[model samples]
Target: DGVNYCTISLNQHIPQYCGSCWAHGATSALADRIKIARGAKGADVQLSVQHMLNCGNVGSCHGGTVDGPYQWIYKLGKRTGSGISYFTSQPYLACSSESRDGICKNADTSCKAENIARTCSTFGEPCVGLSEYPNATISDYGSIMGKNAMMKEIYNRGPISCGIDANPLLKYTTGVIRGWSLMQDHVVSVVGWGTDPEEGLYWIVRNSWGEYWGENGYVRVKSGALALERSCTWAVPDTYTAPEKNNEIHCYEGGENCKVSAKDESTAAAPATRKPELWKRDEVERRGFQWRGNSSTPSSHELLFTPSNGFPETFSWCDKDGKSYCTVSVNQHIPQYCGSCWAQGSMSALADRIKIARKAEGIDIQLSVQHLMNCGTAGTCQGGEPNAAYQWLKEISDKTGSGISYTTGQPYLACSKDSDAGFCKGVDFSCTAENVQRTCATFGKKCVGMAKYPNATVAKYGSIQGKDAMMKEIFNRGPIACNVDAVPILNYTGGIVTAKSKDTDHSISVVGWGTDDKLGFYWQVRNSWGEYWGEQGYFRVQSGALALEQDSCIWATPKDFTAPERVNLLHCYEDGSNCAAAVSATELVVCVIERPFAGSPACLRSPASGSSGMIGSMFQAGWGVCLERSVARTWESFKKPENHANNWEEAVSFWAVSFAHELAHFESPLHDRQHGRAMEMSQRAVLPGLARVLSKPWGSAVGSQNVVHRKWTLQGSGGNLLG
Candidate 1:
């Protein structure tokens, strides 16, 4: 009764801007009502406003009737049983049929199948439409006018969409709008009501603008202001597509693509959702986890196998083959206490799967929980969903062709939206490339963002429950992440935990199951609170203790990962200021030969002149490059007096560019002019600042020609550098 069933915030202006406030308002209200109808369990089901804009006869970016979308969805479900698609299937593109400007100019705003619900193998185009995507159907729709009816509808069901004045809200910021204009133009949803000490009674309203605007994406308006209480709309959500227990719906054909969208429990048989249960966080009870419930009848496969049916009496991925396939134990409380059990648990399970995928052969890879915390849609330090973490991982793999990085690449920094628990006090949680993964400078070099880094990817992932499903997944794959109560195990020393409470507030990975002589059956669970706590960062719980097996447990499959190798790896510039891309096939090995006198051609002399041709000689011996020290010294001597203070640093730059030019030959034909252009472009791509310095003419000190062609020889060392 005390649960907040409202879903996460939404913005109509992401990726691009759209003025579909009517559709956003209507769909959001209906989505909240659907969540309310489903008892707030499982991942929140967000309705797609884009879906409505494409098909809802009511709205566009320009505007439309607030009640029309509800009527349209209700009638669509009544007629065809397919009311609206989910936001996950058809994420917002902020385009509409009415507006042909901006992003909508080339967008497909039609009611085609792909336009309605599409999934892509990558982030870009060439997407296919699922013939049967999950949809939410509405039973009835109606409209009401006046304050009392609006309040009753919201309190009884959920939030209701309402209209409001346009001109006065243009400058509205953080307060209850109170004015005389009854002009109704913009539409918003009224979630609830509150009484301010100064403003008296006000309606808690949500806007289509992003969370950065007004009171966390909400603005309270004075009761009955601007005719906001004059007109309102509400819809009764009837049923939505949901997966059966221990199963998932494939969003695409062949059952090989991403899993279906999050499901709700409500249906024709179970019209009313489960009642809301309440739990709080405290010293003796630290429950911050959630179980995303499932619907539909269990499959025959689910009924065939129970936990003890043909299953081993005891099995553990940790001790399998006398080797621990799991990654090292982690501590979320270090640097500061972070409630990132969700990230730690899921990522650990995924890493263990990766290790198992490799047959526990090579290094036990540890995934970066910090990378997930930095870029994942899953909740943060306060609490979050482990299932959502896997879902987000798969989504990123689809978007960027990669998933989370290793812990060695992006170490843990327990940071999030609210909590600043330790070393993460001033961290940024933006999901940019640099924010996702970046390195700090060393040896006085400026920090450079890594354009390409190694990463692990997800092949498939989904939620599972019940002891049999958990055991089967663990026995087959490796380990799984699940929710726990955490209260009873706070001071646990050893032995099996038999706590009765199932109020899950923490997340931990279940590695395997075991049998105890006196304790009966128990789960071998791994915790993220460092190695010093409770059985060396692990504990055993009686099979179903704290709803360990019943709550949402997550499993992810590792597709492939970049092996950490040094072949063709990026090399640093001579001064360590920037990186020079490895553009050669084989590793470039250079040998430096210092000449005794300047302008002597010491490297080019023949045996006939009483000296062997060192350049010709080294080329015969198969060196990648021959660096003449006299030419380096000549460039140093030719430096301007103004550059004398940084002469040593300039010399380092000169040598780096010289090597860069010779390496450029491997990428192109052995032509001096083409190699020169390739070297110039490579310098600009790798280091723009240094490219500018090398582009300048040396003021007749080195005789007017560019230093690249004047001082540096452009020969391929033995012509083997290309290989």
Candidate 2:
């Protein structure tokens, strides 16, 4: 209750070990939230109860035999939920030096089996031991129970339809499959039969087996949550009667230019009143399934909602104009209509089609990433509905006929949420590595390709243009090449500055691109992300017919502008000063009017410090700028070694001498030289020496590759040299 720690002094007192699971350092804010939310304290304790549900539901669906949502407080009886030690927990043991994998050499160092397992796992593995459990089939019995209850109030949807293990051994067990749920391979559990904590009313609670699984399964939730989630297919039992599907009229029916006569339509209206259970759309379309095409609109098929318990009462759709019930149009992008009628008994029709495709394609595959990406906005995914790609790939894998142990001629398709528009790019799509080659060879192009929509797009990056990226002045904003041309706007392209991958080469990334804009675009593009360079790394392209497809843009500073012109020197001024002393020592200030897009210009001042001194501007400005002042003796020493210019080079050797000198100030390496002697950094020991502005050139992002250099110069002792 007392003030724990002072604001400035708080960081020093963090606890040594976490007090709970899936957490980080002891004192993190997440730890505090969990302490308050779950009444526990552990950094990252924010990995909630619902999130834990995945481990359970996923466990039961894949590994565990029994399942049910026993409360988080119940299932995780002891907070330390136990599991296969290698996957979920690490043993508190030391690895012998010989068994250390050469990663740890000392006795005090350690490595865990969890880390070892991670190293062993691949992207192909989503959850471990997925194939060990029996694959589940969706049961339609639940829907029948719901229907019987609706019409006759006979609600006996017990064990045969949906049952809980309910065994004493499985009670309060985490891995027990409590009951079937909506998602395929998705299962839920019954926590307890008790009054709702918030509602103060009796209810049966369920949990998702995911940490964030329920509202902690806390509400007076609806009955048959899984049934609703699964969207159970509705069909009448033998005892109940309904018209046969074959008797239903369809738009694409036999040899007919049929139109519903006014008299026929009026007669059909009588059925809705007689049945009282029929949907309105069904009644309207009863005369015939012939929908007339409007003069200005595409033909539309009215949807009839057919609920197992009753008829669909309404329909809806979205058009370009945002109308809920849209008229079908020429463009296929808009929704023509939506209705329970439209989908009436649609699930069965789909099931039949899937059975055929599965047998023909030999691809009765499971639900996966490919199914979702190209889902075309379909909200949920159910297996045995159309998944041609998954089916095709699964067939190919099966064709190889190698099960789990036999990772053979072809590897089974791996799924991921990252795949674009629902297709696999294969681990080695570009023929870059051996695995890619193996994958491609085994699958053929289609096997190594996307499953759905044969022509669906896979990658989205625009191709690169010219080579070496260079900073350029604002005036030359064109497709003007950089590396081979003038100056650089940004760093040379294809740079691997901050490597994120274990493979150093993969660290390379495209930094920025150039365009043919007269001025930098993003004039109004402002964001808190990073500094602006052609609208914060984004450039504009001409969209009209004749405009060329522009890919990259690079800019450079004119080498001539770095130094003042003879005329400009005669004008007599420094970066921001004017020197009047003819032969006396004085400070010379240097500055650059930055090219707003790329690279920093090096500006060095001379004389270190001066008294009563007004020096001329050291550099100039024009197609770039020209240097100022007549003191030719002061500015020449820090140039480059000009002998070897044209050949490709390393990041260190090829760095321009002038650029390096500027980088000296930029990195502020603790120089052995005379300048910057009095500079004091917060942690002088932190930086070993001056930092390197660049590490290596992996590729180019904006400009060209070629560059020109300047030779080094010298002046009197103690005199400042501006390169």
Candidate 3:
């Protein structure tokens, strides 16, 4: 035989009992090939097996087939580097038993797992390290059947992955095992083939188990034995260039680039001359007062009125002077393309009003465009009306205390790089529903735990008919929702846009107005295409142009809106006894626990008052009384006291004492006097009530009488008190 040489072999060990032999075997072979193709000049690249195990589309920790690893590499590509870390980069926790089966479990057909295998200086630092191997992909891959073919591939391409019967090789030592049953259940790589004087012919196979298990991490197996070469695969690497370091600042105006077209409808020439039409006052009232026109008319608002007496010459909710009254700036419609302008327009305007109503306190709230997009009855991505979105918001707000959430809570998901029409045509409505449902559930849980603004309603909404009226409304409120012919907006980059059309197909917000000597009078408008587009998510349109004030420009008044009042309450409990309390301006809730609060530290420390708790201990904060429940059968003793006690006395004692203590802290002149005076005042106010309750014949007989009295003294801080 003339062929006996093999490329210098590379070996790897997938530590622990991970069932990701498929990932290890395939990535190891590919890494070896990449090294050989690069002339083996630098350190051998160790492709991440853990990366494939955690982030790949292949099976999980349980054993998987070689085909899946190859398919994942061919599809999503692979990252070449060491094990970054557990979970943060590459997770390698393996099932202790063989009961777990390996299969891709992600719901979506596409693999959307975040890439976490890049090198980093710190364990969880967001930055990917420089030492990480360059990104690489398998250009082409094919199976090599038969022993000679597998051996030939190894000889030519450094190493080839092949399926093997792992049972007979489990306890393998130094020497080659001659014959074993051919049942392939695991995968390994054949790095070389050689003939021994005593063993005859053998294949040098690499194992994923650490070096301590076999002959320095490798095994010399009898050629063709144990189905070692029954099936094998070889792949060729594609030309790869290391990606440029991404150092660009991710501003609100930076995101996926919008496509520009030469024949973009937004910038196309206007049709031959057309006359503007004006609706009569009665007709406008009947049709919801939406404007539809291309050119100006005597009846038009711009022609019929002047700015309100106090309207500002220039104003924007989002201005460079740091006086932005609007909550959110830019947003995107992505993942799937959706025609959701109606939803975006209404939600954006409403969010601005909410910010204005709250006087821009704390962080700006970006209302959920996705809420209206998925739950509203207006229309799907095909197209919709802003009025329907508003009506839907009103109805939902009445039904659910929280009608919409912020962008961080619900986020826009439907995205398309193409036109709104194209996006709607290609979307899967069912999938969109699933995405919204899953996100909303999480939002509901977190929202209830925080101090949320009261649910708001649209008290009054009307179309702004004229330019003066629109500007006045915006100045008085915050922003106004309006319809515009969006054909020219598709290609808008910057500066004043003066294009006009009779057909208004999109809804947007008119945030403020300004004057530009060269570009003429314009309105600062916000688009839902995200901040990366236009001037940091905003653009300017010539005032009274583009049907901006046509058929309907609407503004709403927020009703029943109230801000959350700041309040603090303390819970004091015995070392082992479970007693908890939450105090807000409107309510106080007390709970006696049978078990530990199984929630986050913050939730446990300050549990929301209305949330469900143990039966007898659960009551609204407005009850103005404290509840004491026991885990054992000691309730009969307490029930007897309630029968003879004046309920009003208890309410007076509890709230008067609590309020006195809170006020002492609020009005205290010295830090040391805050807690002490508050507690003393509280105890003094309730002393008479406490004396009456303790004087009861049953209370005197109970051994726990002293405990109840001690509870009141320790009320200001966390402690165990009698009672």
Candidate 4:
């Protein structure tokens, strides 16, 4: 009873306009019922509206009765118990017999064999009909009238479709519409109902015009407004063709090299790049990114999850078991308001997802949406698509090993190429190496572009819609970006938002979902409007009220976004030629010495050794010389009471003289000139430090040196006797 079983939302006018609201409304409601019948478990099953348009002879783009699809699908299932195909098999084409728009002008809107269940080739081949396709069956269907009947049907089962007079809803933005009319022209799904103390009773309706219209593609109209309660259609879901594997055929434009079960939107061709654009203050003074409509195709892959204990009644990435797996809230309206809601929403969700991937253990990894605006990969300050941003980042990750840089590398300026709305106007939005990351010396010193920097990439991304679908994604992974009607939310101060949408022109992130004892189900959203506004930069709204559960929802997977190691070590080769090559002096080098050494304690233990202490000399490796181990052996002998030296100072002086003599040879080859210089410096300079002699063996060199008699004080930090 606490579970959500509703499926994703639908838009009939995408990829072009089509007056197929009747089919969309019917299919969506049927899909929701199917999900409910299935116990709200596994992935939500969606009924194909396209299949209804292609085969069901009820209505076309021009419109038809609300019960057409339900009645037709029910009859079709009576034969083999197989009815309409799944949306994955036959996606919405926005085409029908009675209407045409965009690419649909030349589309085949027929009930022909191929049109019934079709497939196109990715390599430019003729379209063909599929003998086998996944479909959902409707066992029973009927019509209902009156307010009480509609509410009971929905509450007992799922959503129901009904015809409504939408003539007065053209300008509807927020709040419950109160007018009533009997002339029906459009159809929509009534998901549920709620009562507003001030506005009285209302219906939570899901429209087919996409999330950009009427309270995020939904409208809360008075119970009897526009004859909405006059009549409604309901369907009982039967057995659906639930295949373990995806067998649908996918093809590129012009069709040919079609592949079976390739419904992944991530693999689709990337959108064409656009040039950077700047807008005037008056042109984009409202919002940076307005609704450009969804250009990306819907993803067919639904994440399959089986929770061991089911989902919690309330869960949030912002507060999961006392730890917040989310980043701090960001303000997109800073400096001034910028219409980059697309960037702000998408980037914030991405950053939160990255935080979730890292287990919120270390420093947070916040992505730069400004980078998207500057590079013109996603969109400009004028407007763009949030879903497209993920695709662009994925493209960058595939081309280069890196994706978008961190916010520290490139902070948000809220300016485009020509926009003058804020102080950041005229700011360089160029896509250069320096623009990506830069470093400068102190004060007025020279500055240079950085070659590398921290970044996060997208592994795969896709779109999903509806309350349950959005909840599953947030619960399984992290947060998600979704379009919402900003009118009611903009003035929101506190409490749950019961007002519906006009146009979902604003974008925000859905962090999680919770059940309000008084308000019922609500979405926990993160806004980019700053913490000073609306409950600390966030607002809770009735789920699906502003079409927040619609197709405008997009999510991405974080790839290669983990934090870097704490310390970076420089590995030196065995030759020791490139010793301490880094610019920083503090760099630690792990030098490996695999070659054999000559002057070892084992060799010196023999009495036949010609030298008392071997001189440090240059090896075959350039820039570095080997210091014989004999100096350490000599120092060990002096430290003990057994060897020669008058007192402690004399004992230290004997060891110091031996160390200086060998250091001199190491600086130059075993030459007398270097030895004389070292001897002079040892006598003149007073070096203060305790040098610990290392007993490790060094290469053999033929030389013997007498210990010089001079008082020397060596006491400091530990150091190697030989270099």
Candidate 5:
């Protein structure tokens, strides 16, 4: 299943040598569990270890237990402030040389003004003030003593922090570490568990050491071998606060504030026709079944069917044959259970279709559900229409050339427990336009640029009615975004579900259809819930059941899918002396070159001859070249001469040779160590190539053109050449 889940990978490297495994293990596990609980909203949160190292009563550096960090986080509440901070906020600074095992530097111990000043200066941003920094409090924490219990907790929640004897692990570079040691010395977070064919079984444990330490800062330790299974702990975050519900405030159609109470019908009478509830059918229709979405209309493009010949025995884009035309199926749990399924379903379907149209090459394009959730004009966490989301995609694509961005560009942060209305507080959705503009200006760009195949217009999309129509569309095109009654399906773990219901509440993707011997026919559907909830983020629905075949189903075809071409352009300068001129010229060149090359290319001037220098380098470094100053000076000397033919010919020949040498450097930054023979050959080739071009005199005459050569003057130089 394509559920966008976040992983708890340790990004912070303990400075120099510090045995803060206790801090690292506890913080890592807590943060991972929080993100998982939030349905992996793509929020990168690294709980502060420096907070525990400096402030916690835990035995620092030498050794400590998982209980110390857990208790500290529980009491002080981990955050970026005096007591705690995010990894990016405070970062980790190894204890001072003067500070011994139990002793800590005064600066490391507390949030002093000098410490705050230093942090601000280092990061070039205002320190997360003592008051401004928010705390992540834990309601309760306990130890998972047994190995089975630890595995169960991790599977149910997320990672668990545990103690392990890490002396044998010091030299561990790779492979599953298998050794039994009850003398637990260090702590590490058990992120996940996996079994290797050769190595039997192992636990994916996260280490504090930098990425270069283990398997990218993680280790696969043998299961039940080390003391890791002996001790482990887990905690629950107190991030959930009940949403404020005001029954008196009646939100009318179009979300207008009518200011009238629900009981007062005399003011502005509630619409006689009940608006179709697009979310939480079981809850919305608690009293009686209410219509969801407009009455399903028969698809205009529906194929003429033969009653005698039913749908093909079984068909699925995703099957056992490994020949899947549909893009890799994905799942998206709107972080915090936000009721944006309408938007999620439409975006997921369209993005997947786009991928299939593009032949499922390279990077999988995950269109931003958050973009549709926050920026889209449909409904908010308070439910929305799937058609409205499709319409939003069309409108945004028209306005922004490229459709909405990928997930990383704009991540989903609107986390809410209530399916009725989502909470947008403490999210990217709260950023002001001015703040966004200022931040973008500071960073030198706004948004994640335009997408290559951004304009994904629904060529022809309509409600897919009946099982045959849905199956036909899936077999022909790709997956179809459809609504299903999920009230009973929430608790469903495996097997074909056959819940009888006409009320369609939740939106999901019908990727394919298949049949099982025991369960009969079924639809392999992908849900937005986390992978832990269903069969690895996918569930089989009983064919023709749950109002799936009767209700709304959208089939979209990606329009004009084409990959963007790559084009590299560089402006060659005579010498690297004109640094200011090169910088000014590059800014203009980027715009000019970007038109032809849809993707942004590096536009920089070559370094002056001889000296290897990076003169006109952009913030994002790219390849640069250095030309010989003598070559440029020689070309300049031939600008105005008594012998025009000789001088011009020599100038052109030298220019070509210099251009080839610099172009080679631009193309391949790594120098060819095959002596100067290759360079000599390239120089020799340039003259002949220019001679061949010059021989074709009429080649340039294809169009009516005037050959008016201007006298070359080196920029930033006072006098004319050869003066």
Candidate 6:
């Protein structure tokens, strides 16, 4: 049974599937599409086909030569599945015999009684549709290696006979689905091979099981051809003459109406259809950097999600490795390739999350990559509520939104699953808060005679009163939010104490007391170690008396709130007094803000210089001096390698910080009493970028003089950058 193995090898190489083989005929190509062919039982067996045949006794070969030469037809193969049968003729191949004079003689053997081999290949392909091929061509097909190997292999790769066409009628063309491999004595046609950098070669061949296989899903090829050549099968095609439209064709197993070519006997090389050119239609590049596969391979349960209402805000994390990287741009409804590709890089991925959180109820949040970075900073105040975001979120949300519906002020924060180990990448805020004492904890304020403001609290003095006596100097200056807790105060009373004071021990301490609205709001006042103070140390007066007597105040609400302003001042004395009657009056302001920085030294500043009016001077002078001092210290801090940053991104961050410290001084005349000696320049806009030329090696990192911020940003920075 002569079979066309060449046609089988023509169809097996693509990325999708593999072609397995059964009754051996030198298993060659890969099987792509799989389908049901025939056979009732499913088991494993081997089939043996006769490899040689005597064609009218031309002993050495065919071609009407000596004694009707004997020739090689198809080989045998072993396969797994049900039963077995031998295959007959298929039209995809053709054969021509060579005379002793080396002439390939074509016989009048076209299956359809015509001269051309149309059914062998689509058109413009090799000759086909015949039973006996010259032994030389058959033997030559075996020496080939891989897709890129020897010249013999190169000969098998032209005309791509294996790709799946759109035609539904060409089903069995792929072979595996046809169950033709099940035949015991059957050998079939050849297809193609696989040469992906990964898996090598599989096979593709045909059978007599109608057109059910449609070219795929039936056989298996020897994995790498290492030891299974004995299982190879082969075939030959009979050229069909009458052509039919592809749509009108049916599942015919043997419509072999084709013919062999006259040129088969030359043994000369076939002309290649292409030539190398400098210009190419495809691009090639090096791919060495992929240490791992380009994409991440997460665990099975890993899923990407767009948080409920907090899309991009709430990111789902499935760890492929131990590190915490965020896939913030996930889309919950569709797989990543649909209306959703990984949404990253652009502003939409992050900013959108923030806008979403703003609309949600419960908590106010800001969750951006930057937000994550902020919360993760070794330096953020967290609105003075240290270590509280998580707990605060817990408190705000109703259980319905507990897991995630709770919102945020900023949505695009780089987020990952909250691990039990804690977000290891962030700063330990709880620890930082507990250690606040290490950063600043010394409450020691001092006052004498009379303070400038009404809300003064002397560690030693209570609200003293009367003319030129020890009690008169007690309540003077306004309270100081200027220092850390306004502690360590100096009391100026040298009088006796009484019972109500509880011996907090001071010549003049307010100690503590009850307020009576109807009784003029009394203050339980205490006095010095001398006189017989009210029962061991104190006495009470109307609540309103404290305000009138010493300039005390009410606790103020937030600026936009409806509560009354605390410490609302009523000037004690003014400019209408006669010269002889003029007594000194002190002006004090109790502020609600804490000192901005812990160690920024305090200064007793006057109104700024060069300002035209008294009001302007008062507004700027005292503050300007303090800021000048702060700028110098910041410059010094940037000198060390550990602190000297080179990037503009980081430089801008520092600029904001430095500006903040300066604003602190501009607004409050006395505060943060700590680093005055470090002054170099008065403000960020004023500090020269890249310190003085001569001091580069020894001096601090000063800012650029020409880089003042924009008017808007400047306005917020204590309103200075503009003019």
TM-score of each: 0.42, 0.17, 0.38, 0.40, 0.39, 0.14
Which ten contiguous residues of candidate 5 have the minimum total lDDT? 434-443
Local distance difference test, each candidate: 0.60, 0.19, 0.49, 0.58, 0.50, 0.21
Model 4 over residues 491-606: C-alpha lDDT tens digits?
45566888765546667899987899988999888876543345545678887687676545888888775243422111211111122111110000001111113322111111
Clashes of 2: 89
lDDT by residue for model 6 (1-723), tens? 111112111111100011211212232221111000101011001111111111212121221211011122212111111111111121111122222110112122222311211121111232233322111112212222232332233233321111111122222222122111221222233344443344444543332111112222123232333222222322222111111111111111111211233234433222322111111112111211111111223411123232354312111111112211111111111000010001111111122222222221111111222222223221121111111221222222223121111011111211221211111122121211111101000112110111111111101111112211111111111110000100011121122211121111111223223434444333333221111112221234433232223321111001110001222221211110110111110111101011223322232212221122222333455544454455456544433334424443344446435544454454445665312411322232223322211112112223432332211122333422222
Expressed as tens digits, the lDDT of each residue in 409-498 for candidate 5 is 233433321122122232234222111111010012222111121224555456657877777777667788898876666555566888
Output candidate 3 Cα RMSD. 23.7
Using lDDT as the measure, the top candidate is 1
Give the poorly placed runs of model 5, Cα more than 4 Å off: 1-311, 320-334, 415-423, 426-457, 560-723
Say which prediction, candidate 5 or candidate 6, comes out ahead on TM-score.
5
Q: Give a tens-digit lDDT track for model 3, residues 1-723.
A: 222122212212111124566766777677767756654322223454555654565675556777777777766653532222112122232322222211112112222222332211111222221222234567778887787788678777778888888777655656686676567887887778788898889988877543223453467888768888678877776543211222111111111121122123243332333221122344434544333321113323334333456666678875524444654443333322355666777777987787667655432345656545555555455456676556556566677644554443233444321222312332323212122321111111221112232234555555566677777777767788887776576556577888876767677888899989887678888876543345545678897677887657766666543222222111111010121222222122111221212221112222333333321122333121222221111223223344326353453355445544444533454788766765665565334334433433231144443424322222223322223
Per-residue lDDT of 709 in model 4: 24
| C-alpha lDDT of residue 432 in model 2 | 12
Instruction: Candidate 1: list runs displaced more than 4 Å.
Output: 98-106, 122-125, 243-723
Clashing pairs in 1: 42-292, 287-505, 288-505
Whichever of 2 and 4 has more lDDT, that candidate is: 4
Q: Which ten residues in a row have the lowest lDDT in candidate 6?
A: 332-341
List RMSD in Å for every model shown.
22.3, 32.4, 23.7, 30.2, 18.6, 42.1
Model 2 over residues 238-336: C-alpha lDDT tens digits? 110001112111110000111122223321211111111112223334423212111112211112122455311211111111211110001000001
